[model samples]
Target: MTRPLRVVAAMSGGVDSAVAAARAKEAGHDVTGVHLALSRNPASYRTGARGCCTIEDANDARRAADVIGIPFYVWDLSDRFHEDVVEDFMGEYAAGRTPNPCLRCNEKIKFAAVLDRALALGFDAVATGHYARLRTGDDGLVELHRAIDGGKDQSYVLGVLDQAQLRHSLFPLGDTPKPEVRREAAARGLLVADKPDSHDICFVADGDNAGWLREKLGDRAPNQGGAIVDESGEVLGRHQGTYAFTIGQRKGLRLGRPAPDGRPRFVLDIEPVSGTVTVGPREHLAVDGLTGIRPRWCGTVPGTLDGPGVTVQLRAHGEEHRAVVRVTGEKSAQTVEIDLLDPAYGIAPGQAAVVYDGGRVVGSATISATRRAAVSAR
Candidate 1:
């Protein structure tokens, strides 16, 4: 029998988290529920069911803890959230790259900060509702893998975690599907059972990335307006800001003119300093290789980078691409070079390229550069 552990459950006022905490308690673990206060003024954050880490979410989490018969407390991590996740996000956009803030939050806040605090407070592990499976490998190392429910697998974001973090983390709801979790939440008398799943960037409030960036960046924004150019250096249109566009974006270009070949155009590149937004045919967005920096390994550091059967995931919900990975540099300067056997479209810098050996997560790296597929525009 496994020993009972003192676990801190991170309740996000969502059905999954509530059910996870309840399951942990049921498993004979000493569990305490804690809600993260991510927003300085939660009032300005999203209300209703749209986004999480709001004032309403904290209350909901407290209520769920009450029902689960566990002690609950709110940890004020607004300052950390702002500096790590929020600021990093703004800075990435300003640098003309697309970063996954969720990945950063998991790396810096949830695992790094929260796990550090939990260990300091005598907790054996910090449990969350993340849908990723953990198992002890033959080498006695803990491995992170995809959840049984493929549709809800979140191992991609969690690929940032290292061996120590995985050892001290618990995900009780990984094997169960989302529907079963909701039903279990209802059975446990948790009020958040019917709460809608949070969507988009939690801090973005409204879904308008451009408008929100414009407001936050203010005078600090690169340019109020810039020229949108095609691959041939022909100016297609003007955009309010380069931060407003991302690679592979087809909508909202407002180009006002179609391509010479009458083909729909997509954003090809973003140059923040020059305030240049490049647009071209969709074929131009295909990338065959990428250079990834800041590699974070989950378990054993892979020695054979050119081995077969390696796959990489570039987006949160994106499909896996078979690739050959090579590691270069040393320590903090180490970078990964991936040659994708299957070309991916619109892959952008600052995005995470999660490496997976089958279902098990090996590690992840931040995409720094991409090699576009050879193609000539019409």
Candidate 2:
């Protein structure tokens, strides 16, 4: 609520985070920079200064802290990250679901685990370089908002933040444009000023998820051995495993039977138990509605959201769709049902379905299941 508050700047050894910590310090906050060592072996995580989990990143973070004239420390969060984010990622894929590790990290790591530790250590808040804004809502409470720059709006990824996390978080890059942040980093003499932006999944350093999963899971990997099937339970071909297929994935099916229209077939379903990968035309991926498990509301979910005002975001950088959410059940069984106004494709399970009320993120939920709109491939 005031400047000069004790804050921990979570530096990622990139220009954005470097500039973020610098901004927090410049604003008179007693900022202490901390770099999270998220890999079991830093050297083998991701080579070069291009990735967040690399040793170069840690060094860059320390260098940034030096330039900012603040104390910096490297915290080993590898164990927690492995348990919460990495393990969960493998588990989801094993179950024929696609999980967003970034969202998981935001929910379980940066905000939950790290915030708990920071609070216990007497830090008022954790500041990051995420492109998001915090403003007092019409209800007079702090609320998360999309960044002013629509292109860099990371509200979708940060949609996992709940009321408590939002209150104790600061995003200094919220109002600053991407280019401006780089310029600021350059002006401040931060060593990471020219570092490349990290992309893909940080933990999956090589970007080869299938190969990585195979190595990690061994015999348990989904693509290790499976059969390719059709909608009617007819086996079309043989496959290595089913985890390699996701909803709306058409390119890698390698199916011989093409539709009458000669259009390529797409992966429609993944039956992990049967070790069966279902293939169908693109229309089969259309979903009527989705049920999200473990809903995390950003602020508060109104009691009665009967129709169409609810906006459902299925991907981190995808378009929002109109829907209606009904908060059902209670406790661990709590879930939300979203009925889309128009059918959407690629509604994969285990992916997050973040809900929004206007420009503000109202809440988010992990898609546990989807009710597909029936389609006849013949």
Clash counts for all predictions:
0, 4
Give model 2's TM-score versus the native structure.
Answer: 0.94
What candidate 1 gets wrong by more than 4 Å, as runs, is: 44-48, 306-308, 376-378
RMSD to the hidden true structure, all candidates:
1.4, 2.1
* Best candidate according to TM-score: 1
lDDT of 2 at 159: 86
Tens digits of per-residue lDDT for model 2 on 287-337?
989988888888776554645456888988888888887887875678888
Residue 149 lDDT, candidate 1, scale 0-100: 96
Colliding residue pairs in candidate 1: none
What residue pairs clash in candidate 2, if any at all? Answer: 223-240, 223-241, 224-240, 225-240
